[model samples]
Target: MGSPICPDCYDYLGHVVWQYHAPELWRRAIQDVSRQLAARLGVPVSKVSKVVSRQYGRTAEMQARGAVHFHALFRLDGPLDEGIGAACGVGVDVMVEAIEAAFSRAQVQAPPTFECDQSRVLRWGEQIDIRIVREGSRTDDPDAPITGEQVAAYLAKYSTKDTSLAVPDGAHVHRIKQTCAEVHEAAILRAESRRAGEEVPVPVDSEGRDHYVLIGKWAKELGYRGHYSSKSRCYSVTYRTLRRRRARFQQVTKSRCYSVTYRTLRRRRARFQQVMQEETERAQRAGKPVDLAAVEEALLSQEDESETSVVIGVWEFVGVGWTNQGEVEIATAAAARAREYAQLRAGKQ
Candidate 1:
């Protein structure tokens, strides 16, 4: 986990200070950590096959203590074995130490501006929690086993939340409002300077370049900027691939159903027409009335020979319905109507 320090610098810079660039800062931080871990493990950067990372954010109190914090997950290739290491041949314990070192070394330099006095150093919080994931093994903590499914669900749930929905009672909210006002004033000044053909001074960092902080653009987010979730190229299968697979499945199913139904219907129709033609020719040759019952029986016998027998059943009437009162009433009415129709068909109505 990484968090920003709420320094006194914010009094001058407002919420658009170095901390506002949490997204970029942590991106660099994670990269640094990965590089350091790879070097320690003796793995060449080109040979590294998999490195997955994701980021999640939470709003801090609006007071001076308020700033966005990040939750991150990292996965490396292979098991926790020395053989998997590249150069130094270290294991998981050593990798964890390398991460700690990287966090300490990772820092974000501020673009020299009136709002900031100096570049800010970034690091993880003191409460660093690291755990080893193993299959079918529970942890000592009350949270118990840390399965991949649980972790994914946890990250996904928070990633979709609205950051702007945080309560508006904190000091951070006040600073954000103040920053909005300042940004508005700056825009007006820039406009006037441009109309007067005057060169408006812009703040630059130590690199001697103009800092790009479009304060108005991020005012609604309280100047905090970063993606809720991100992943490396080789992390997992992409959304595009899943969608394509689903589309193909649906297409195949539809084609199969249509082809089967058309083939069956065509075969039955051809057989029926052939049988009728044969019966007509026999009647004409005999010069007598057609034996309709025998012809029908012959066709049915041919069908039985060609395919499986069609099962038919006649059951005695039993009590209607199962449990529901409404269903019982409907079933009783249906049974009475069925008996009346049967009697009429038998000429006994």
Candidate 2:
């Protein structure tokens, strides 16, 4: 269930454009909130902790209109002395009011360099919603209201998906192009009637591909390719920092790294133990029982008493192929399948 819409008036292109700018608009709205809070607290704007944000949206097909609405999760922070966590948790109402104030004054400007007819400048849609997230809760039931973790997860989920509004290969483009061409043909027919002084209704190309003054300028957005990830000053960690940490981890765990070399040697030791186990199992199956339990116990005791050694700067593959642990697992599974197939064939014989 979502908002009401009329297809003729609910421009799909406009919805797409909004998606593209949604990220920027959200950031502005959140910043506006922080600013208001700082002003009320008599603290410098810089001292106001930043809020983190996550992206979320809804796509609904309605009565001839497609509505795309977005929601954002915002987290607030504070200075250490004031106990930031407690402040943000308890002052949600204050934050909400501040955010509402900011939204009232928030205006998103399109890129200045683009040439648009001032007559049809775009802006945010009519409806806006802001809800405060509560602790340890997933949702505020519409009848009972409980929004929190549910809100955060929701926003974070959409942080990476762009709507299929203008998919280069999507159905919408074919429809739009066909519609435009039909409108163009109709206009030409009406022009002929007009020359004869007939009051024929003329169809105007309100949304033509050549009309950069309108939706054409935003075509690349299909029309929504906005900021998918954002947060207020005090929300959570930055995307940049997360990316840096991942890069660092990758560097340390690089295939040629010393840790990988050590892991390789460990695998080799495991393989040797596995071979010994297999030989023991075969000996038992042959009915020439040679204290199999005692042999297993001895092997375990030896393993416990012996320390496996590994080189710090070299990586090795103990198995037939030079692959790491993960790859080895995959290879081992394939080998098992092959053995099963061979056994099945032998059974058929």
Candidate 3:
């Protein structure tokens, strides 16, 4: 079950606009972090590159209240040669302080809406958390610092998070979609007026304007118009680069990087599906019933390895979902169970 919505009126326009500009806000926030880091380390802003470089991996999550939260892993490294090792001089406490100051300094002047008739200042929320990622397993101490794998897992889990919210009476999830539609209608009228050369009074912010029309296009996402996950250019290998590498590169390279890579997880998923099919086929040939639990255990016990294989077969498109009503019912029941489990876990969080 989702969280209960409040009875009070919500500024739907402001909410959507803030969600629309979240990417820009994050960009400016990171810049502020760099400035803060420079000040903390007594280095000039322009010369900070010579001393250290800042890199981050971020994933955006939507709260049950329909607000965006970011889980980011920020690291400071030396200029070019010393690598992440040089960051030891700055320490985690300084990073935490820089993050706090950055959050305070980061603000975006949102576009004016019909309801408010003035530009709004959007800032990060008060609930801030900073964690130090240690190199190895955590100690038995209750306050032991978390490991890199723990941090990466936290980000990976939330990057695929379920989103649900409804404003007004807060009874149905469709209410948020309805709100997006209403906002879209107003924006359409405003655009029409501008095209006809009529004077449409829209407040102009000193920073500039944002396109509000995207709210309707992303209505299913409750007006969030930004990426679910992003990272700095130097943080890790990008998907485009990885795809290029997979095509022509015949060698394996080693480099210090994030513990989790989305591309690797995707490849593992395809491999898992292939293994399951093989196991089922083997069981069928022996005239034996398939044991799903045993198959899962076998997969988990095996090491993560893959080989180059020749795939010579005629493949066909499979239906997106169950092909029959009986199977549909079973799938629906399974989905309901999964949703309930997710709700339980969310409550624990």
Better of 2 and 3 by TM-score: 3
Q: lDDT values of the candidates?
A: 0.54, 0.49, 0.71
Model 3 error, position 56 (Å): 0.7
Residue-wise C-alpha lDDT for candidate 2, range 204-236, written one tens digit per residue: 343522222233333443333343343443344
- Sorted by lDDT, highest first, which candidate order results? 3, 1, 2
TM-score of each: 0.53, 0.45, 0.63
> What 10-residue stretch in candidate 3 is worst by lDDT?
247-256
Give RMSD to native, each candidate. Answer: 23.4, 19.9, 18.7
lDDT of 1 by residue, 1-349 (tens): 1123553454536336644666666667666766776676567655443332222222222223445666555555442221122123235576567667766676665543333244444455676666654466434466676765655655766676555454344555666557655754665555556567777565444553235436556666566555556665434544665685576344433543344356655876787688778887986796534545445556555642324446789788876548688987998999999999998999963
Compare the candidates by TM-score and give the number of the best one.
Answer: 3
Off by over 4 Å in 2: 1-24, 44-68, 80-90, 108-126, 137-147, 160-162, 165-220, 232-234, 251-349
For model 1, the run of ten residues with the poorest summed lDDT: 79-88
Q: Worst lDDT window (10 residues) for model 2?
A: 111-120
Clashes of 1: 9
